[model samples]
Target: MKIHQLQALVASAETGSIRAAARSLGISQAAVTRSLRELEAAEQLPLLIRAPEGISFTEYGKTLLTHARLVLNQLEHAQNDLARFRGRAEGRLSVGVTPWITLTFLAETVLLFRKRMPDIQLELFESLMAVAQPLLRAGDMDFVIGQLHPSTATQEFSCEPVLNYETAVMVRRGHPRQHCRSVHELLDQDWALNFAPDGQDALIEYLFTRHGAQIEASRIVRAQSLGTLQMLVERADMCTWCPTVLQTAPLFQGQLVALALNEKFDSRQLSIVTRRNSTLGGAARCFIECLLQVIRKHARSARKEDLALFDTLTLLV
Candidate 1:
C-alpha cells in the first residue's frame, strides 16, 4: 500500500471517522475512504468497522495501526534529523511527564531548554507512568520523566535517575490526623488517591493488600491533576499521598503539611527516560544536557539548604 494510504488509515483510526480524518489531512472524504479501502484490500483484512457511534479497529486492525504509527514516526524523525543537520535546531520535541513532575520540575526544565534552543518546538503531555511508557516505546514521545519501577527496568529505554524521595501523607495545615504516629491511626480518615491502574497506585494497592488493609476504594477521590488534589486537600480534611518534592514548596510557604508515615514507604526514583536505540538530534541532545544541568543545580541547592537546616538544629540542640 502507498504511504499516503497508510497515513489515511492511521488518521481514520485516530479520529474514528473518515470525514474527521479527511478534514485533518486537508483532503476529501471520498479520497480518505478510497485510501482506506485500498489499504484493507491490499492487506486482505478489514481495518475499521464503521458503526453508529464511530469506527472501531478489529484485532488485526489494531496490530496494523500500531505498526503504521511507528512507521510514520520513523519517517518524521528522519525528516527532523535532516533538518537538524542543516545547522538549525528546529523540530518538534514531544515529552511526556507524570502529573507530579509537571507541577514540580518540568516547568523549570522546559523554561531552561527553551532559553537554550529557542527555535525548537516543545510539546508536553502529562499522564501517569503507565500511559507514558507505551507512548515512549511507540516513538510518540522523545522523552518522559516519571517513576521507574522494577517492571520498567527491563524496558528498551535508558533511564537516568534524577531524584529519590520519600512518600508521605499530605494534608492542609492543622489537619487533625497530621499528628498521628502510625498508619493505623489515620486508617479511618478519607483519602484522595491517584487511582490509575498502574504506577504508584498499583504499588500502593500491593502494599496495602500485603498489610491486609482493604483499600478504601470508595473513599478514593480519583485525581489526575496534582494542583487540583492539593487544592482539595487544602480546603477539606482529606489527605493524599505524594512525594516530598511536591510538599517542599508548599511546606516552605506554610500552605501544606506532610505527615510522616509510620512505616516508611520505599523511596521512588524519578527518572528521565529516552529510547534505547534511537539517535537524538542536536536539539534533543541540547535539551537533555540543559535538563541535566537544571537537575544538578536544584539538587545542589537542596543539599545546601539541608546542611543549613542541620546546622541550625545542632545549635538549638
Candidate 2:
C-alpha cells in the first residue's frame, strides 16, 4: 500500500537481515521493522522468517519479493520520466558494463559525458552480464552495456546491437611461438582466458578438440580481470583470447600482438540493454550516444590500420 513498506521488504530480502537493511536504508532498525510488519499485514502473509543466523524468505515471501522488485523498478523509471519532463537532467545515472568493454574508449566517453552534464552523477559498474542483469531488473542500474548471450533474458529487456565484437589470439611480442602457424603448435604453451557462460569456453573447447590438441588443465589460467590477463600474457610466455578492440590500448601497443593463427575465431555482438518500453532520461540518452560515437571513432581508426596493412601486403605481392 505504501512505498516505504515495499522498500523495507526488498531491502531486507536483499540484505538477509532487518538490521543490515535498516543500516543500508539509512534508517533506524525499529523503523524498518515497523515498515516490514506493515507490508506483511497488508499482504496477509508471512514473508520472512527470522532466526539466529539472520532472516530468510519463505516461499510466499519469495513471490512477494519478485513483485516488490518490479514495483520498485517501475517507481524509479517513473521518477526518471517525471524528472525528464520537468526539464531537469539532475539525477544519479548508474550504468553497468562488462570488463572487456571498459577501456580508454569508455573512459573518454564517461569523461565527455561529465563535461556535458555536470549536474548528473555517473556510476559505472564493471561486471558480467549475468551479474548486471538482476541489478538492472531491480532498478539499481540505469542500463547495461555488454554482450548479448543465448542465456540472456530477452523478454525483460530491449537490446540494440552496438558493434560486432571479434576476438584474436594475443601474446607478448616476439614470443617463441609467435611465428607458429597453427593452433596445434601452441597447445604446449600456457593459456589465459576470461571465463564466462558465453560462447568463449565452448569455442575454446571446440578449437582444441578439432585441432587434436590437448591443453593441460594446470597450464590453463582462468582470469576474471582483463588487466590481469593482459599482464599475464605480457610478462610470461602465455597467450590469451582477447577482443580485437584491445589493440587501441597503449599498454598493449608494442607489447602484445595478435597471432596470425591458421584457425578462425568466432565473433560476438555487444549491445546496450534497457528495460523494455521504459522511457529514458536525457542523461541516459546522452550516455548511449556517447558510447556509439566512441565505437564509430574506433571503427574509423581500425579501418585505417587495415588499409595500411593492405598497402604493405600489396607491396610484398
**Largest TM-score belongs to which candidate?**
1
Q: For candidate 1, write residues 61-143 as lDDT tens digits.
A: 88888778777766776787787677666778888887755654567888889887788788888876666778887778877
Candidate 2 lDDT tens digits, 187-232: 8888887655464556568667666677776777777666678778
Q: Largest lDDT belongs to which candidate? A: 2
lDDT of every model, 2 decimals:
0.71, 0.75
Against the true structure, what is each candidate's TM-score? Answer: 0.82, 0.79
* After superposition, candidate 1 runs with Cα above 4 Å error: 27-30, 51-54, 130-140, 152-158, 198-201, 204-207, 250-252, 274-282, 302-317
Lowest summed-lDDT stretch of 10 residues in model 2?
Answer: 308-317
